[model samples]
Target: MAALRSREASGVPLAWLIEAVTAGFVDADVSTLLDEREERTARAALPPSFFGWLAAEARVAQAIVSDQNEGDSRVPYREVERAAARMLLEFAYRLMHDDPDRHFLDLPFRFAAPAARLGIESSLVIQAVRVTERRWVDQLLTAAGERAGDIAHSVLSASAAIYDAVVDSFVTDYVVAQAQLDGEMLATKRALIDALLKPGVRDAKGFDDLGIDLSGHHVAVVLWHPTAGIGPHLDTAARQIGMSAFANAVTVVPGDDRTLWIWLTFADDPPPAVLERVRSIPRDPGRVGVAIGPVARGVQGFRRSHLLAREYAAVAGRLPPGIAPDIADTERMSYLSLLLRDPERAEWFVATELGALATGAVSDRENRETLRLYLETGQSLADTAERLRIHRNTVVYRLKRIEQAIGRPIASRRHELYAAALLAHLLEQSES
Candidate 1:
C-alpha cells in the first residue's frame, strides 16, 4: 500500500488499472492489491488515510474521463465535486480506523490540510470542468474571425467588378441615345427645307399662312447669313420694316452655323429707302451679305428669284455684314456672264442697249409672268397664248411689247432674247 501510494503521488502511469476495469478484471481488488504491496516498501511514508483518499479521487476522475469519451453522460461541475468529497471521506475512514491516539473526526481535518497543499479546493472540480469549455469557445471564435475576413474580401471584389460593368453600360447607352437624337434633329431640318423650297409654296395662301397680306406684292427680299447672329438680327430688322403686314418671310436653317437663308416678299416695289434700312440691320461678329430677289405672285415665281439672289450674293461678295445688296445691280451682268459664252460682249450689249429697260420699264411682276408663260410654252407663241388663256393676237401684242421694252427683237436674236428673257424674268419675280 505504502509503495503504491508513493508511485501514485509521483504521477506514475495508472492506465493498467483503468484497462483492468474495462476488461472485466474482477479479481483485481484495488484496496487488497495495494495492501499486499505495502510490505515491500516503507510503510511510514504516507498515512493509510491519505493513500486511500488519493486512490478514490483517481477512480472518480477515471470514471468522468470514461463518460466524456463514451459520449453517454455529461459530467456536471457539482456532480464532480460531490464524487471528490465522497472519496475524501472514505480516505478518512481508512486512516483513522486503526488509530487509537487520534479520534476519527481529526483524521478528516488532517487529510484536508494536505489536500489544500496539493492545490485542491472545494471548488476545484467545478473549475476543471469550466477550463474545457473555455478552450472550446476560443477555438470557435478563431475560426469565425477567419471566415468573416474571407467573406468580406469576396464581397469587396464582387462590388468592384459590378461597378465597372455598370459604368461601361452607362457610357454605351449614352452614346447610342445621343446618336439617335442627332438623327431626329437632322430629319426635322430636312422636312422644314422641303416645305419651304417646294414650288408655289409662296402663293397668296402661302403668304396668308405666314401672316402676310400679299394682295399687291411685287418684289421680295432675300437675306443670307455670313456669320452667327445674322438670323436673329435679320428677324428683328424684318419685323421693324413692317414685315408682319407687307411681306411674308421664311427662314431656312442650313445646318451651317455661319449661314441662314431668308425670303421676304413685298406688296409693291419696296421704296428705294428700304435698302438702306436693310443695310442698317445689326451685323454678326463676322462679315454678312444680303441679296434681293425679284418678287412675283405666290411661291412659284419666288423660287427662281430666291435662287438668283443667292447666286448673285455669292458672285458679287460685295455686301458688307448686315448690308443689303441691290439685286438689280447683279442681275444683268451676272446672268449674262452665266448664260452666254461670250460674257464680256454680252455684258457690253446689255449695258449699251437693254440696261435701262432691264432695270426700269419692265415691271418685275409682268415680266416674270411673260417669261414664265414663254418658258412653259416652250417659246411657242400659240402655246404661250393658250396657256395664258389669251388670244394669239394678245400673245403677239405682249411679245411686241417685250421686244420694244428690251430694245431688241426676239425673232432676230433668238438665243440672246431667250437668255435675256429668262434672266429678266428671274430678276423681275425676285424684285416683285
Candidate 2:
C-alpha cells in the first residue's frame, strides 16, 4: 500500500526506492512501511532530476539519512538547502557566461535558506537564479527604456551642489582681485587731481570732468595730511550732512603724508552755521590747518581759490592741537591778501616786493631770518637788533638795504607794504 501511494504522488516509479533502503535500517517492530506516502509527498515537491544531480555531486561514498536504528545520520534540512542554492547559483553563472560589463552573481542569496530548509531546495535554487537573471535584464532595460523622472531629479541635485561651490569660489577670488585693483585705481585718480589742481599744472577742462560746474558756485579749498585719517573722516562726515548742503563738492586729492586738498562750492555765501559745521569735525593729532579761498569760477577760478585758502591757513595763528585751522583765523596777516589770487603770483610777488634784497648780493636765507626777527620784534629797530645779537646801527643799515631792495620807503608804507613783504617771507620760509 505504501509503495502504491509513493508511485501515485511522485509519478516516479523509484519513489519507493528510498523507502526500501530505509527499511533495512529499521526493525519490523520499530517501522512497518513507515509513512511511504509522506516520503512521496516530500520527493514530489523536489525537481525530478534533483536527487540524481545531488547523488552525482556528493563526494562521500555512502548515502546519509536520518535513521537511528541503522546508524545512518541526517544533516539538518538547512544545510542541504544552502548547498543546493549555491549549486544552482553556480550553474546560472555558467549559463550566462562571464562578461566584463555584466554581473551574474549579484543578488543576496541568504533569503533562500528557509525555503531550502523546507526540503524544497531545488525550487529555491532555481528561483534565486531566475531572480538574478531578472535583475540584469531590468538594468539593461532601464538604460534603453523611457527616462525615469527620479533620475533627472538626482542629477539636478548633484549639479546644483557643484555649481554652488564653483560660483562661491569664483566670487571670493573676484572680490580679492577687485580690492587690489580698486586701491590702484584710487591712487591713480588722486595723482591726476593733484596735478591738475596744483599751484601750477597747465589748466584745462579737468574740473568739468570732475563734475563741477564752476559757473554758478563759490569755491573753497581745504588742505590736510593724507595719512592723518582726517581726509577720510571728513569725507564720511560731510557725506552724512545731506547732499543738498554740498551738491557739487569735490574732495581733495591726497598728497603725501603731509597734505591733502578739497574743493567745495556753496550755492550762496556759506553761512556761519555751515562753516562751523565743517569746522566741528575732529582733526588729527597735529595742528590741523585749513585754507578757504575766495569764490572763483571754472578751472582757473578754482585754482585761484585753492591758493587763497592755502595762504589764509598758513598765516593763521598757531592752530590748537587736533583743531583744523581756518581762513577766518588769519585776519591779522594782511600780507596774505596779495597771494589771495594765486600762490604762484605770491611767489612772484616775493621776488618783486623784496627787489634788490632778493638779488644775489644778499643771501636770501640771511635776509629772511632778519625779516622774521624784525616782524617778531614788532619792527622795532632796537628790539630787532637785540634779537639778532647785532648792534642797533647794523640793524639800521640792513633795514635801509631792505627798504632799497623793496623799492619802497619803510617809514611811509611801513603799515601796508611792509606787512605784505613780511607775509610773503613767512610763506616762503614755511614752504621751504
Score each candidate by Cα lDDT: 0.44, 0.46
Q: TM-scores of the models, in the given order?
A: 0.28, 0.37
Clash tally, candidates in order: 20, 3
lDDT of each residue in 10-107, candidate 2, tens digit only: 55432232332233232221011113542254344433343343333221111221221133233343333333333332332222232222333332
TM-score of 2: 0.37
TM-score: model 1 vs. ground truth: 0.28
Give the per-residue Cα lDDT of candidate 2 at 151: 36
For model 1 the local lDDT of residue 380 reads: 84
